[model samples]
Target chain A: MSLRRLGPVAALARHAVLLASGALMLIPFVWMVSLSLKPPGEIFRAGFSLLPEQWYAVENYSRALTASPLPRYMLNGVLVCGAILSLQIAICAPAAYALAKLRFFGREGLFTLVLIGLLIPHEVLALPLFILAYKLGLLDTYAALIMPFAVSPFGIFLFRQFFKSIPDDIVHAARLDGLSELAIVWRVMLPMAMPAVIAFSIFSIVSHWNDLFWPLIAVRSEQLMPPPLGIMAFKNEEAGSDYGPLMACATLVVAPLVVAFLAAQRWFVEGLGGGVK
Target chain B: MTAGLTFNGINKSFGGAHVLRQVSLDVASGEFLSLLGPSGCGKSTLLRIIAGLERQDAGTVAIGGRRVDDLRPKQRDIAMVFQSYALYPHMSVADNIALPLRMRRLSGMQRLPLVGGLLPGSRTTQAGIAKEVTRTARALGIESLLARKPGQLSGGQRQRVAVGRAMVRNPAIFLMDEPLSNLDAKLRVQMRAEIKELHRRLGVTFIYVTHDQTEAMTMSDRVAVMAEGEILQVDAPQVIYADPANRKVAEFVGSPKINMLPARFGADLTHAAGTTFDVRARELAGTAGTLGIRPEALHLAEAPGTGIFTGRVRLLEHMGSDLFVHLDLPHDGEGGTLIARLLAERAPQIAFGQTLHLGVRTGRILVFAADGRRVQPDPAPAAVLRSYA
Candidate 1:
């Protein structure tokens, strides 16, 4: 082919590939929505339609909400996730500032240990943590659900990296202005590191909100169940049938994370790219 | 307020390597003192120690007659202009200049975005800070750029903002660490003059740190020459140039460094180059010393008897108003080459490969011991051993 003719073809092929990958990524959500609208008999039937012949969304939503106290489960999830995020921000912001700026003894060693936490997966300590929670008689409580996820080593590490990229002279200037260490972190460093903190908050909220393992291990009471655990109850209570209600609950579980990501998308990218530049 | 500043026996070490060893100096009220040295010579470290950014292992730092060794940087009443001009990227020029006062005056709850304005005394304090910032910005001629962020301003403008930020505090001492290092050559010169003028106007003690000797020489009331973490000498610029305490100070202060020639002396008080010379040592006759001569101090002698050394001119570098002639001396053993700086008017007739006689004035000739210490002329023959030893 001529060079001129080859250019557009290459561009078209690239676009086509991207469009196909995008559609593939959306396939699972599309199938779930389609299955929710289908009747029980037609859900697994051959020649399944992407669009349902019958409209059952209203019934499916109503049944899902009424069947297993999903609204209450969602509220529990929000509280647990909200508590964890608040604690993480409260703890990590100052810790990050100290690691980035202050000159206390054993600071670098402590920071290195925190970074070592990133290398170990949470599963390695899951059983020990559960046993500890059991010993404290904290089983079936929201504390068990929120406490494990509260202290985020990754969040501290991220914020520390972001804070280190800030010029030390500015911090010195702040110190020279008579701002205390905490005041410097809260007033100056926190405002400057908003993008990283926001980005890390989104990461923390999404991961903790979507987590089912710790919630499953800790809380057995139905009233204290988070949304993801509630989905299992919705599946088991309504038996092997009723694909409609299950899909509705699943969609509901995914909505908050999607909305949050959309809200903080700009800061998310900027924060993730913070120290790399 | 009586004594401006004093760094008494300040010592700082990193790991095992000592970066500053017993560095001591004093600055009087309204005096401008410069810590001048090469890179890694610990000049910046000394300034930071004075500013309370870095702590000395064993010493006391006093500002305005108050011991500030344990005090925080703010409590010490000092303001520093950094080399990078570290203006806050997110804030406008006005807010940056107002930050110090705002932090001092406003409480935590009174600094919140929405509730701060509603606080009881925040409004008045905020107004006062704004007025101070406006006056400082106007003084720096950066009032028009107040609303712009640091990224929006040029380098010179950013420097002005940095100065304005430091000026708003009106602290007892101003510590500047290579503040003009980031500017271009032309701008550095212009800003150098501006900083000198600012110092005169403020009439506050200023401790400036720089590796550029010209910047120190042209601006400071007294220049402290530092090398290898130790201050070699501190004096007025002209005094330092004319009378250096050691060979290092002699070589560091001037352009076209002082030339050193190894010479041997005889028992009969006769001192000659390897070939021959009329120069004689009346005192400390049998001792060996390195003869130090400035490039401009050597003159072209018309005859053989008046000159001390004879050499053939190898090459010539034509500067705008002067000529630098490279000479090849047969007696310069293993010591690469000798340079003679001559006036352009007298240099035109001197051609390459022509043998010329160079004469150095006896008064301007600096003699150093083998250890680089200046060898002074001894008054008594008995004390000559103590002096030359």
Candidate 2:
């Protein structure tokens, strides 16, 4: 068939592939929500239905909230993620500014080191980090959880790329305007790179919120546990798997991210693809 | 206070390439000077050096007779407007204009976002700065644009804001690096006059860098013609145009460019384009040289005679006020071309392929030796040409 005649068929195939993958990705969450609303007798039934004949949402959610310290876990999640994002920005922006704007010896080698840092996963350093935290007497505390991810290589890389695209003239103008180098970062570069900041914040928060590996190794106390660790604790405390309340807790943990992503979806796309105007 | 500036033996290099060499200049207080050259010719580099934006490898710059070599850009008593305007993209126009003053007048603690205004004296200082910003905006005719971001303003409005920012500081000197280069042609012409007027009103020593000769000529008290990292000539605009120091200055300063004819300087006469003229250079005897002639110096000769170049008219360009006739010289082995600018009314009968005799006003003939240095003609030949005219 001619190219013009094949256009509709091609579009239909493209959308079919997209919808199929999207549904594949969304099935687990849908199933979690479905299971959270079904009682014990309906949960194990062979026939699959999205809605339960007997509603169990209130009982499961209340149990998820009260039987364990779910609110405390979420608050811990908020504190850890907020602290990590703030520390990351404080450490990374200056480093990124130096890499992007300042001319000095060994800048290229330093940037290469950062690129190599990006190559190694954080999981590889968990053992050393745990031992270091033990020697520092910070284990089972928020310090242990917040310290490791503070200076994010990815944050530096993202910010440097954004700052490099900003004209040197602006920096020069800032210097002439009598702003110190650090003031320029906060007053000029950071504000101008707002989209990149939003994009990086989303990445940091989502990855840390869903993070199960390092937090499992770092903190052991019930109060210090974030959501995923708390859910695991709740499972172990109960006699059975307790699928209804467990799925409800999972739904709660995932809801904030969904709302946040929806609210900032526009900035995320712009941050990834665009820089200053 | 207005102050004079001086640079002594400034030299700069980047990655082993020399960008400037032995560059030196002096500007009197309240005088407007332009560093004029093509791109990469180091005019902007020199201006940056003056503003302390770029450090020269070996030099001393004195602003108001104080050595500024050790100072940072902010420490120097000068303000610069960049070619890009470089307005802070996130700030309102009022804040942008107020920043320099704020940096100087306010304490560090008083610059905080939320708690800043609560500091003692902060409110009054801020009010003073706001009033000054409004006054500056009004002077630039951008008072209505105070609340808008730099991104919201048009190129011309942004340009005015940048100028206002530079002006509010009231530095001893003003440095502008091709500030009008980003504007469209019509707007450029309009801004050119405004900048000149700004200089007149401020009466501050202004160092403006531009590649456009017209901007340099029309706006500056003196134009420093630069090439290959060195200032070739610094003189009044008309002098630089009328009496260029060398071939490069002659070629660079005017539109339609000065025409250069390769000539052999013999005992008594100069032979060029199959025509002999009573043009002799005493110091350039028996050597090859060039005869520089402006387009307006050539008039229509009634018939072929001495001191006249004979060629065939190849093209005519009608620029409403003046007619430019392009002639092809047959005798030059390279097929040399010459352009003679005439009044549109005088060249009414000229047509393509017509044989034309163009008489040179020998008094205006500029002679240069093979090395591109100007050579004064023996006054005798110019007198003969005057008699002929």
TM for every model, in the order presented, reads 0.88, 0.97
Chain B structural similarity (TM-score) per candidate: 0.91, 0.97
Cα error of candidate 2 at position B28, Å: 1.0
The 10-residue segment with the lowest total lDDT in model 1 chain B: B380-389
Per-residue CA lDDT of model 2 for B257-297, tens digit only, reads 89899988987888877788788787898999899999999
lDDT of each: 0.83, 0.92
Using DockQ, give the best candidate's number: 2
> How good is the docking of model 2, as DockQ?
0.82
Angstrom error at residue A189, model 2: 0.4
Segments of candidate 1 deviating more than 4 angstroms? A1-25, A37-42, A53-55, A119-141, A220-223, B1-3, B265-284, B304-309, B312-315, B331-335, B350-357, B377-389
Residue B382 alpha-carbon offset, candidate 1, angstroms: 22
